[model samples]
Target: MSILYVLLTTFGVIFLESFLVALGNLRFLFLLNVSLFNKINWKHLLSLSVLSSLILDVIYHYVLGTNLLMVAVPLLIMMGISLAVPLENSLPGYSVKFVCIFLYYLFVAFVPNLILTGQGTVITGVMLGGMVLKAAISVLFCVAFDIVWSRLRKKEEGTKLRSL
Candidate 1:
């Protein structure tokens, strides 16, 4: 049930992001296409987001001694919000993506620590270090997913052409 919930939440966030990007409302123009609005591959994005979220959850639990859902739910929400609210004319480059992911994890990790436990002391700088680590992980995951998705799409197109 918990895993299902996490999967659903992660997919939902990814769908929202894809929709926003398709609408040309996203701040980052990392990739451009003629059919930017119509060519979004939602399934790929959702799968990638879920996989990345799972990885992040594992890291959080092993290192921070917290449950996966506790971290994943808020992180998904933060990423969704960040995607929905685009920065001014900011092209989505590696740096922009890195910062966005980092900020999402940092906020999800730190704010709760401060608010819920009232333990604001930095634990071996884990808060800061974790953000960078997670962000890099996310970026790499996204890049790999994008590559795989593109290849699959190309293959599908080629198959259709051959059949025709």
Candidate 2:
């Protein structure tokens, strides 16, 4: 099924990235609660990812005039990464989410395109527009996912307390 493929690919990419970052001594993986991702309501994330991918596909096709898998796949990857990682308290602000999305897009989307396809361009005005759009979508989806996660987590906690 397509859902299985997406989950497999997303997890594979996340695992590989975490491994490489560990090898590189980046320690970025410490920011995440890995178990939370597996436990969190995945159906919500999956639905959002698919919707975001389709919307991005249309945008890229119509606006950029390029069928760039690089753009879309990385968006999905970001969705996974967002779910995996928790924001630090010091960085607690709305801007931090956008920053996370922007960095993810830059490193995951742009750098790979440069290395693999030999295509590199400065983040220009037009590219910034697209980046902003991507970040907006990421923030929106992240917030929605968090809302559902919090509600579900609270309900579970309440049930546990009641059982005691």
| TM-score of each predicted structure versus truth | 0.38, 0.41
Lowest summed lDDT window (length 10), candidate 2? 26-35
Candidate 1 versus the native: TM-score?
A: 0.38
Q: What lDDT does each candidate get? A: 0.46, 0.46
Candidate 1 on 1-45: residue-level lDDT in tens?
Answer: 546754665565545545643663331211221112123454534
lDDT score of model 2? 0.46
Question: Clash totals for all models, in order?
Answer: 2, 0
What local lDDT score does residue 54 receive in model 2, on the 0 to 100 scale?
A: 44
The parts of candidate 2 lying over 4 Å away from their true place are 1-91, 117-119, 155-164
lDDT of 2 at 74: 38
lDDT tens readout by residue for model 2, 43-147:
634443444334433533333312234344434554555565644212343355566556555554455456546887567777666667766665655566556
Alpha-carbon RMSD, each predicted model:
11.8, 12.5
The Cα RMSD in angstroms, rounded to one decimal, for candidate 1 relative to the true structure is 11.8
